[model samples]
Target: MPILSRAALVEHLVRTRIAGDVATPRDNNLSHYRKLANGDRHYWLGLELGDRWTDEQDVLAVMAERCGVIDDPAHRTGQDTIDPELTVDGLERMAARLRKAAAGQERVLFATGHPGALIDVHSRVAAALRAQGCDIVRIPGGLVADEGYVVQFADVAVFERGASLWHTHSPEPMNAILDGLGEDGRPDLVIADHGWAGVLAQPVQDRVHGLRGVG
Candidate 1:
């Protein structure tokens, strides 16, 4: 069965504050875009944006197209809305990719930066892929990254700091895994969310961003 009918998925997303009722503020998003436009590598999340975008408005344009946010530069300090249909589309696309990987028994590496909200979701997907005979690639434990260690639990890699799985927007933990895998033993596909996903996975560009109340 489908994860949810499209209508049902949209309802659940709004109910759960995943798309509507989002938590980001307008200033934060504009600031991030400004920093990204100014060539701050941290916000690029591992993508080599280079000097291609020198204006924050231009950056906002790309983000607006990709994320379904309103594209008005004049609307300065409230929450921006996320397009629920776009959110549904993104999730369905992820489902399709998982189906393909399972069919091919592809070697897939799973990782998450938002552990508290998503670890169980990633772990459950990892488990299902393994059941389908796909290779769920494992990263060696305690690998060095971002003043912490890269750790694995329930078949998903996470950034470990102070002996706990920590929230992160850095892509270093994923980078560490790729380095360790080497060219010969690399995974055929990578499943990730947030910065790690943005840096190492093909679907990163489809990710959506939103603001809290500026609509």
Candidate 2:
């Protein structure tokens, strides 16, 4: 289903509950402001039966975004702490963001930990997302540590790496990547699969409308 239509449904529901009428904003552009005020309609908590798929994180992130909720940590401030490892699932989610950024013609910025472990998953996901219209680029760091911290610093950094490089990979590089872009993508949307404290920050929380988990 389309995000706009889904957002429309959410808006209608919100207005009907409060005023017995659907406000249906003229803009037709559903944003975080509408979602945050109306109540989160997109996020849900629970793990899958097991780590069964290669790109489960990607699948879930997309589902969560479509549903209008951020995944994992319900709050926008970001995860309290990120994992020390990037599971195959984690890599997949980063790939999905890369794909989304690419499809929208946005310059994708990707980072991950245990590059060797995530490469296969990343490759598969990158290939799939690229096929769909996303341009992919692999940041130099293979398995980045302190991903949550670095991501918070970057204009748009995908968190797939673990916490090993956080201290070493200063926020400067992240800022540089964003600065190099020179221009933000139209209709910019930032999505994250992991990063507790990073995503919980004020602006990120404000911008993201929902989170949905997919099998």
Candidate 3:
């Protein structure tokens, strides 16, 4: 596939329902937000929430600010929206990070929870970075329990040019990878989404870049 310009990418996001009238329903978002506010371990995805996030409204507010989701507490059902502008802004920011990594020949790791939708994008970026001499790190391991189901490490495949990830919402995979890092070892950059992104960002905020509100 051809690389899309910023404007073209924004249009693609909208047309694909990755942003603007997003496929994630408002009710589902509220349910997740409620779980987060209530301190549900499974939903927290390795984030350490402060006491101020005790209320669901507070979570909603934060989501709205970061993701451009509707802020209204009254929104109970139907399609939730992700502002295309916010999606574009996030993509641009990610692109800038990738550019820096390429320039520095940074060691980078890529993972995702929305593999069905986003693998192509990540693979292309990984290939580009490889062309620039960046080492794309491959995490090796086996299946691990997440919530209830087992997620295989092979499901998240690392190749010569890029990697392919399967769907996963739990942070366990990322935590395992971080735990196994060598002393004085850390990827210079991590590209990921959903819980994978959140977990990686917790310990090393500067080296991780991700899109918020993607399911």
Candidate 4:
């Protein structure tokens, strides 16, 4: 499939509900922003925000610039927009990074906290990277974290507990994978989302790896 141009992609996003007016409720967005403002790590998505985003309004402003969400503090709860421009900007950044990875034949790890919704996305990227001569790093088996064993399905890393695979936001599974990697190797890039993002908040013990968490 040919890649869409910026304009075309923006239109496609709104047409497909991937951007413009999204399905996530305004109240939900505000709630998460409030939590992040309150120093809730769960809402931080694995980032060390520090004192930078303690105010909800400040958070909203940044979101508006980067995510296209409504910036008005008075606009509380109603329809919110995900600016297609910002969304496309993010897509472009991800594409550029992937291109670099492919050119370098870098090792990449694919993981997702939202398996039901994003597994296919991760799998497709992993396949493309593999085809481009990148190493699709394998998750070590028999490792456990978040009360579950880390596992892989469809070329993407995930968690399996209770004899079944499950979705998670915990970074423990990812940390386990890194620990299991030991001195053998580490991925140059880890593409992850949701709670798996939190792992980045904790320093990687001097291991230099890129974490791409697409919201």
- Which candidate has the highest TM-score of all? 4
| TM-score (all chains, Cα) for each model | 0.86, 0.29, 0.78, 0.88
Clashing pairs in 3: none
Better of 2 and 4 by TM-score: 4
Q: Could you report the Cα RMSD, in angstroms, for every candidate shown?
A: 6.9, 17.6, 6.0, 3.1
- For residues 34-59, could you state the per-residue lDDT of candidate 4 as single tens digits? 99999987777656668989999888
lDDT of the structure predicted as candidate 1: 0.79
lDDT of each: 0.79, 0.36, 0.69, 0.81
Best by lDDT: 4
Please write out the lDDT profile of model 1 over residues 1-215, one tens digit for every residue.
55568999899988887886567877788999999898887788766666888899998898788776668998778887677888888888888888888899988888888888888998999899999999988886558999999988888898988879998878778878877776665787777877786665323343222111110
Ranking by lDDT: 4, 1, 3, 2
Ranked by TM-score from best down, the candidates are 4, 1, 3, 2
Model 1 bad stretches (over 4 Å): 1-3, 201-215
Error of 2 at 5 (Å): 28
lDDT of 2 by residue, 1-215 (tens): 35445345445545544212223332222233333233332211111113332343454354345533335533434222212122223545755666556667643334332233443554555555556666554333332333343332232343433443322213233333333433432123333232222332224234232212201
Model 3 TM-score (2 dp): 0.78
